[model samples]
Target chain A: AAGVIQSPRHLIKEKRETATLKCYPIPRHDTVYWYQQGPGQDPQFLISFYEKMQSDKGSIPDRFSAQQFSDYHSELNMSSLELGDSALYFCASSLDKGTGGTDTQYFGPGTRLTVL
Target chain B: AQSVTQLDSHVSVSEGTPVLLRCNYSSSYSPSLFWYVQHPNKGLQLLLKYTSAATLVKGINGFEAEFKKSETSFHLTKPSAHMSDAAEYFCVVTPPGYSSASKIIFGSGTRLSIRP
Candidate 1:
């Protein structure tokens, strides 16, 4: 079974710089979700998209934006990066049933972002 | 509102001893519960999920969880701990009709340590 794939397994950036992360969800999966895990902390929900449409939003910062393309792939763009933004960024894909009876999210390896 | 709480931050067990990771959840409606394991520098893997089907959900690597509605708890357990089982575990809850803004909620996480 093919799992979710993320680009740039590890990234290093300087303050005020910009970065973009990509996520290719599993085949047939229509929902994509983004999360951030800081050092010694649990993963926090950032944002999510269903069928290329923004379905939900969490604690994502204003400097960050994301969009799902027609190919079902998604990208997260961050600008004016800060040192505090350093963390593990994870992408998850799930089959959206519209209802909540079935929404098992499959996660990718994650990208380790280090803002210097 | 839906939230999950992990009872312990860290748990240590012998290689052949039983393993227990406690989790409790609160949801306004019937919620889908899940247990995910994350190894060092790895993505989150689904250990098991409870979608109001079976109270006892079995997962990979000899892991299982029992959902107790009365206690509002879904605790993960294994008969014998393995050295490779050392990882961080998270409890998550997604309420019904979660297609809207309210997404999944994750617990603080519990780090499991296995001793040889």
Candidate 2:
């Protein structure tokens, strides 16, 4: 089975720079969620989209913005990146509940972001 | 508010020994709980989930979790530990309101190390 796909498995950026991470969800999955995991910490929920619409938001920073495209893929764009932003970014996808029952997300290989 | 707590930051067990990872959750409403595993440089894999159907949920790879509402605990357990099971495990919770959107909160990960 095809799993979620993430771009730029590893990224390095300097402070005050900008970066974008992309996620291609599994086929037929209409919900996408983003999470950030700092070293030795838990994965924190950032934001989520359902059927191309922003459905919920968590602790995502103001400098970060995300959206799901018509293709069901999503992107997280960060600006004025700070050293504290360095962490692993993960994307997960699930079929929306309109399809019935509860939604259980499946995650993709995460992108490791390093700020220098 | 919804949150999950992983009681241990790390656990070590010998091969063939029993494995236990403790988790506790707090939610305003009925919650859906999950266990996910992450191997080094790999994506998160869903081990099992509790959606109010059964108290004892059996997952893949002989892993199982029991949802005890009265105790507010959903601990993952396995009969025997394997070297391949050495990885980080996360306890996750999603409140009823956001279940459709698949928004979830994760606990601080517990890194499991297996000895030969």
Candidate 3:
């Protein structure tokens, strides 16, 4: 089975620049999620896209946004990046709504973004 | 609201020794619990999940977790520690009042260290 795929394993940008990350879900899977992991911390949920619609978002700032296309791919956009935004971004995909059942998530290799 | 707490920031175990990572969760409803592992420079990999099916859930790489409702704990265990198991482990819980599509809450994470 194909796992989730993320592009640009590493990225470096300056403050006020825009950063975009892409993700491709597993074949035939819906429900894609984006998370941010800082140094020595847990991954925080950024946003989720399900069935080509924005589903939910965690405690991300307004500079962050996401879009889903055709239910199989998604993009996370960070406008006007800040130093605090530097972190590893992870993309994950699940089969269904994941309603307290066996629907587990598969993750991508993650993209490390650095803001200077 | 839902939250997960990993009791230890780091755990060290010798090779062939048993390993245990403690996790506690707080949720208003029946919680969906999960354990994910992240190797160096890699993505998050799902080790196991609990969703009201079997209280004891078995995952890949000889890992398992038992969901103890009475203690609000879902601790991961391995009969023996392997060198490859040295990584970061995260305990996750889904939001209490929403469907699986809701955003997930992650623990601070526990780093597993294996000694030869």
DockQ each: 0.65, 0.59, 0.59
Q: Which ten contiguous residues of candidate 2 chain A have the minimum total lDDT?
A: A94-103
On lDDT, the stronger of 1 and 2 is 1
> What docking tier does model 1 reach?
medium
Quantify how close model 1 is to the true structure by its C-alpha RMSD in Å. Answer: 1.5
* The candidate that achieves the highest DockQ relative to the unseen native structure: 1
**Per-residue lDDT tens digits of candidate 3, residues A1-116?**
67899988999999999999999998877788898989887877788877888878776789988899975799998999999999999998877755432357789999999999
Q: What is the lDDT of residue B107 in candidate 3?
A: 86
* Model 2 score (lDDT): 0.91
> Candidate 2 chain B: worst 10 consecutive residues by lDDT?
B96-105
Deviating ranges (above 4 Å) for candidate 1: A99-101
Error of 3 at A67 (Å): 0.6
Sorted on TM-score, best first, the list reads 1, 2, 3
DockQ of 1: 0.65
Of the candidates shown, which would achieve the greatest TM-score relative to the real structure?
1
User: Which stretches of model 2 miss by more than 4 angstroms?
Assistant: B100-103
What does the interface RMSD come to for each candidate? 1.9, 2.5, 2.6
State every prediction's TM-score relative to the real structure: 0.97, 0.94, 0.92
Candidate 3: stretches off by over 4 Å? A98-103, B95-97, B100-102
